[model samples]
Target chain A: MQWLNLLNANFRKEYIEMKRYLPNTLALLLTFYIIFLAAFFGIMFVGDPASFEANVQYSIVSVAFWSLTLMTMNFIGFSVVTEAMRGTLEQLYMSPMGVWKIMLTRIVGQFSLQLVMMVILLFAAMLTSGQWLSLNPMTTIPILTLTMISIVGVSFMIAGLAIIVKQIQAFLQIFQFVLMALVFIPLSVAPFLAFAPFVKGVDMVRMVMMENLTLSAIPLADFGFLLINSMIYFILGLFVFHRCEKLAMKKGLLGQY
Target chain B: MEKIIEVRGINKQYVKRKTKEVITAVNDVSFDVHRGEVLGLLGPNGAGKTSTIKMICGLLQADAGSIHINGLDIKKKRLKALKHISAVLEGNRNLYWRLTVRENLEYFAGNRGLSRKDVKEQVEKLLKQFRLKEKENELVNGLSRGMQQKLAIAVALLANTEVILLDEPTLGLDVEISYELREILKMIVKEEKRTIIISSHDMPVVQELCDRTIIINKGTVVVDEKVENLLKLFETRAYSIKLGGTLSVAQEQQLLVKFPLCTYEGSSHETVVNINLEKSEDIYDLFDIFKAEGTVVESIDRTTIDFEQVFMEIVKGEKAYAMA
Candidate 1:
């Protein structure tokens, strides 16, 4: 029940802030839309005509995943930096539910909101390019949910660093491209990247959307691998975050910017 | 009185980034705050007041020693221990400026795991209590600094914690608002009976609101005594004497040698000397200097000392005040 309250409070805060900062939020969506347009035009003008349909479908899914992963993974880090700058980081630390729980609830809240934005962008991209890939919510959601756990874990790691450093904007600016590579690069091209956070889930979701596969149609081992990969990153991310929190406290960096 | 917060010999040190020189921010400091007591943690800048407050809030870790809140060790059971305490740290914008006054209150309460339904009545009470009802829907950024501060404090109160640490609650307010905040705090102290630890340089706030004060200097506890007792201690030793005539050079030299901290001010007809004596007999020594000049003593009055004067004498003297 307490967790529910925490979740509700954070979700409401995220929603209110998004509504209040409507212009900035819309600009962010437009930025993603432009990125998608760039991908669409690049494929149309530069790619082979033989695989034009397949290529456009692939770019649309990749662009949507890229925006989703980039926002989800970087949200907590940016949140921490903003809180520290706004001088509320220490106030958040006063929560008896623990800062990690607050951060987790906030990530969940942000993920939900960003998911809405991602859908809008996905549709916009499809509408502009006149290509629609199968958005198998049933198969894609469960996989995407599993993928998000790993993303949440990695978000904690970034938030931990932000707690100590307090100036990670430059780092985050460069991280969007890293997320883009991770989202667009196929598992077949780099099989070893499966061990990385969210790669397996993204690959699975992409395959499900592009190939129109059901949950049961995918091999059970693939699900098991994705689940284990997420759990490990989730746990590791939490461990790193806790360590960083301790370091921040020890160094008296939690309130510094 | 039951002890609600116990801090034992906590130490905090920071190294300068440029020079890598280790500076002790708090060294071997210890104090206990009793239930329903108001404590003024007073100190000059660089005197470790902030480091001490942060340690108690569990926002900063100590290099040595331990702190327990309601019998839970902060180091080992931090989140559990935090259940008993909340703080509005100095120089920190403790509220969301983008959020409305009501939203900030409800959100902070919610952050502490309390449902909006649970805090609705209390939120209404605090808004009215802080006289912020008219501006409840306004964003915090639009409110005056005093209102923002009041909202920050109201947010802390909504947590329903047994202990609240307010660092410089009246730091930047105008005189009217500062007085208003002091009055609100006094009412809270009288009515709520919650343990409060306020660290501030605002002497009037400390003098009026605090039951006792602990003065820290150079990273160590210099004086720990009750507010009235401190005022009385300094009050008894302070004296203002009016002399009938000017003193000779020899008598002036004797006065300076005997009481270095004493001040002498004079016009053509009269000389006035304000001095704080270390012992009762020191007054006799003062009179002898007057006698040497054959100066008639017109009047002698024991000066009433406020908390600000007492604080200055203590901090400027840099000596541990022995409380009897």
Candidate 2:
């Protein structure tokens, strides 16, 4: 009963916040439009419909897979961290709900909205003859899950940093830059990214989007290593958020904002 | 009295990150709020009232202390300890700003796991009770400060917990809103059987709404007594004496020297001398001095004291009471 209540409340809270920031959420949606338009225009220039479709497919998948960190990190920063600085953050911590529940619900809200945008972008890409990377549904699912799990860790870490510094804009900008370059740039470098957990899952994503790699392409040992690695980072991120929560309480900034 | 909330020997200190200078915010403070009662956690600005309230509500984990809500240890069983308590912390009302006033109520009600039907029923009841029905659809940002405060407090009532904690419920409110809030508070106490701890600098809020008051200053409890007892004590000790004629310099100087607590307001239009006697017997010494100085006394009245004046007198060191 309690869990259901929490889940329901979280759903309601997320709905209200999403509704409040409709303009921004729509603006985020426009990023998908640009992706489609680029795919459409790029294909048009390619002249051959088949060539344009493949290029559009590769670009959309690459961008969506790559942009997960920037999207989640920024969303958490604005929605959760900024609210925490404003003292309203105490509303959750002081309630019967655990702090993690609040963090997860807000993140899920970000993911849900972003997921919708990704779908739109994919459709637009399809309309323009764009393609997605090749995938052995089996290898792709587990690997993407690991990558997402790792992204969750990164999200938490960024949220914690924002809490400690009580500043989100500067940190969000820096994280977006570092993540785009450090995390995704290496994957964009080549197929070798699958060997490194930091960029491994992204490499798999890029390869699949290019239709160059599939489930049987990777060793089973590689998947295990990536899972363990992402789990560690996720746990560390959660630990830091807990510590940051304590620090905020100590300062009594929980309500002073 | 069955104590609904007992904070035993709580101590809190904050260390600066750079210099590591520890600032003590609460020092060995202890108090109890009986079941179905309102206890005023009173203090001057910068006093430890807010810190104590925070600790009791589990908002700030105490450095060393045990807070028992219905005798359940707060530190050991935090969630269970908190099940009986709800606090309206300063401006943080546990409310969702983007959510409509009704939605905010529903969200918190759902957080408590109340049935949807019950939640809807209660939300509507609360909106009407708070007189927020007309503006229930308005975004919180659009509400006035006083309305926000009222909504925050109304949300607290929805919790239906055994204890309610309010930090400065009347601060920054206009007189009308303050009166309206007090009426709501009074109604809560009379109609609802829930304990309340109100931390505030607003004396009337304390005097009218609280059965007892615990005044903290400089990280320590300075005064803890029943509201009526303290009011009665102050009344017995304070005096307003009218002189038949203007006082001579020697008499005025002696009055100043002898009773440091006295406020001698000498005017040709009205010669009124006010003094807060240090001891009940001190009034006799005052009378003796007046006789010795040959100052004719027109009339003597033990002034009717207000809690604000009493609070100021205590905080200013002119009135001191031993507290635990």
Candidate 3:
């Protein structure tokens, strides 16, 4: 019950911020869309129809993966930086819910809003490519949920870095490209890449979308692999984040930016 | 009265990132704040006042020692202990700038486990009490600095914490707004009977509101004494003497050497020396410098001491109080 109330408060706070920055949010989305369109046109003009169709499917998957990363890593990460700059980080630390729980609740709220934006971006990408990847809720929801666990971990890592480092835009920009590669690089080429964060979930997503495999039809071993890796990344992210939080507190840097 | 906050041996150090210089921001500082008492945390710049306040509010973890609020240890039970305290730091940084004034109040109250009905009632009362009813719907960013500060404080009050930590509450405010805030805080301290720990350089705020003060310098406690006592202590030794005649350059230099903090004002024909001596017997030393130049002592008046002068004297290493 207490968690629910905290989550609600966090959601409202983020909602108010989003509404206030609607113009800037829309400009960012439009910029991403234009870039997506340019890439789609380049592929259509260079490739044959059959290959173009395959590339469109990959693009849809890539969009989903990148969208998750952008929302979790960029939004959550930069929000932490902004909070520090505003000097509200200390106020959040003073809250009765504790900073970790407060951050988690804000992540849930911001990620939910990002999910809506993801949907809109996906539709825009589909319309530009003249292809639609049909999503089956039964398979898609569980796969997306599994993928989100790893994304949440990454968000935690970034937020923690924001607290300690104070300035992380340069790091975040480099990470955006790394996340793109994590999505586009085929996991089947090297099986050992399974341990990489979000690789298993992205591979599973591609199989479900490209191979038309239902949730149950996918082998139990593969599902277990994704699940286990998700849990590992989630817990590891928590450990790293808490360590950074402590370091920041020790240096008295949490409220400094 | 019970101690609402017990901060023991709290210490913090910071490393200058670029220069790699280690600085002890707070060093083995310890003090107690009694329930319903207004305790002033007074210090000069870079004196570890903010570091101490932050540790007490659970904003920054101490490298050593412990802070207990309402008898709950902050380190071992952070959330439980923090539930009893709220802080409005120096700037208006504690507020959500994008949210409306009323929304911030409601969110902070609701975040503290208040229900919707209670949050609404409490927020309305705070808006009125802070005289922010007209600007309740305005976003925090759109409000003036003083208004934003008022909202930040109003939000802190909505938490209903027993211990309220105000860091530089009257900082960077116009004279009128500063006076208004002091008045409002005085009323809250009197009526609510809430324990308050104010960290401020504003002397009047401390003199008017705080019952006791702990002065810090160079990350260490210099003096912990009651406000009235400190003022009185300095008042008895402070003097303004009207000289009957001019002093030679030697006498002026002697006065400067004997009393470093003293000020020599008025023309040579009618010079006056205002000085605060450490001891009443030190007056003889002052008179010897005057007598050396054959300067006649006209009259001496006891100068009224304000908290600022007392603070400066203490921070200057002129006096130390044995904390009781």
Candidate 4:
């Protein structure tokens, strides 16, 4: 019940801020849409005509996933930096619910809002390219949810670093491309990427969407691997975050920017 | 009285980034705040007052020792210990400037896992109490610094925690707003009966509001005593003497030698000597100097010592006052 209240409050805050910063929000959506258009045009003009449909469909999914993964993974880091700059980070530390719980709820809230925007972008990309991949909500939602666990874990790691460093904007700016590579590259091309945070889940989701596979159709081992990969990253992310928090507290860095 | 906050021999040190030199920010500082007591944590700049406050708030880890809020060790069960305390560590900077007054209140309550519904009445009460109802929907950035500070405090109070740590609650406010904040704080201290630890350079806020004060200088506790007691300690030794005649050169030299801190204002007919004696018996020495001059003593009055004087004397003198 307390967690529920926390979620609701954070969700409300996210919604209000999104609305209040309508221009910035819209600008973000426009940037993603523009990226999707770039991918569509690049495939149309520069790619082979033989695999145009397949390529366009792949690019659409990749673009949407890139935006989602990058935004979700980097959100907490930026949030911490902003809070520290605003001088509210120490105040957040005063929460009995714990700063980690607050950050988790905020990530969940932000992910939900970003998911809506991604859906809009997904449809917008499909509409512009005239190529629609199977969304497969039943198969995709569960896989995506699993994938977010890892992304959230990684976000915690980034947030921890931000807590201590407080000047991670340069690092976060470069991280978007790292997220793009992780999202756009296929697992088949780099099989070892399976061990990376969220890579397994993103590959599974992409395969499900592009191949129109159901949850049961995918091998159970794949699901197991994705689940374990996410849990490990999630736990690792939390561990790193906690360690960073302690370091920040020790150094008295939480309120500094 | 029951102790709500116990800080036991806590120390904090910081390493300079370039020089790599260690600076002790807090040195084995220990104090206990009783339930329903208002404590003024006073210190000069770089005096470890902020470090001590942060350690109690669980925002900073001590290099040594422990702090317990409501009997839960902050280091062991931080979140559990945090249940009993909340703080406005940065005054207005603790608030979400982008958020409205009411939203900031509700949002912070929510951060503590309290629903807006749960804090509805509290939100209303605090808004009204802080005189922020008219600007409830205004963005915090749009509000005055005093208003923002009030909202920040209201947000802390809305947590309904047993202990509230306010670090410089009236640091940059104008005299009018500072006075108003003091009055409001006094009411809260009187009515709420919550343990409050306020750290400020503003002496009146310390003088009028705090039940007890702990003055830290150079990273250690210098004076920890009741406000009235400190005032009285200095008050009894301070005197203002009005003379019917001016002092002779020898008497003046004697007076200067005995009371180096004493000040004298003299003219043709009347002379006045203001002296803060190191001991009550030192007044006799002052009287002796006056007698040697055969200066007719007109009036002698015990000067009232305010908290500011006590603080200056302690900090400037670096006196480690022994409390009874």
Q: Model 4: per-residue lDDT, tens digit, B15-83?
A: 999999999998888899999999999999989988888888888999999998889999889999998
Off by over 4 Å in 3: B113-115, B237-302, B319-324
TM-scores of chain B, in order: 0.92, 0.91, 0.86, 0.94
Tens digits of per-residue lDDT for model 1 on A1-257? Answer: 99999999999999999999999989989998998899889989999999998889888998888889998899999999999999999999999999899989999999999999999998999999998878989999999999999999899899988988888889998988888888888899999999988999988888888899999999999989989999998999999999999999999999899
DockQ, prediction 2: 0.41
Model 3, span B149-235: residue lDDT tens: 888888888888898999999899999999999999999988899999999999999999999999898999888889888888878
Q: What is the DockQ score of candidate 3, to 2 decimals? A: 0.51
Q: Estimate the lDDT of model 3.
A: 0.83
Order of all candidates by lDDT, from best down to worst?
A: 1, 4, 3, 2
User: Could you tell me which residue pairs clash in candidate 1?
Assistant: none
Weakest lDDT window of 10 consecutive positions for candidate 4 chain B: B315-324
Instruction: State the local distance difference test value for candidate 2.
Output: 0.75
| C-alpha lDDT of residue B292 in model 2 | 83
TM-scores of all candidate predictions against the true structure: 0.95, 0.85, 0.88, 0.96
Per-candidate clashes, comma-separated = 0, 8, 0, 0
iRMS for model 1?
0.4
Candidate order, DockQ descending? 4, 1, 3, 2
On TM-score, the leading prediction is 4
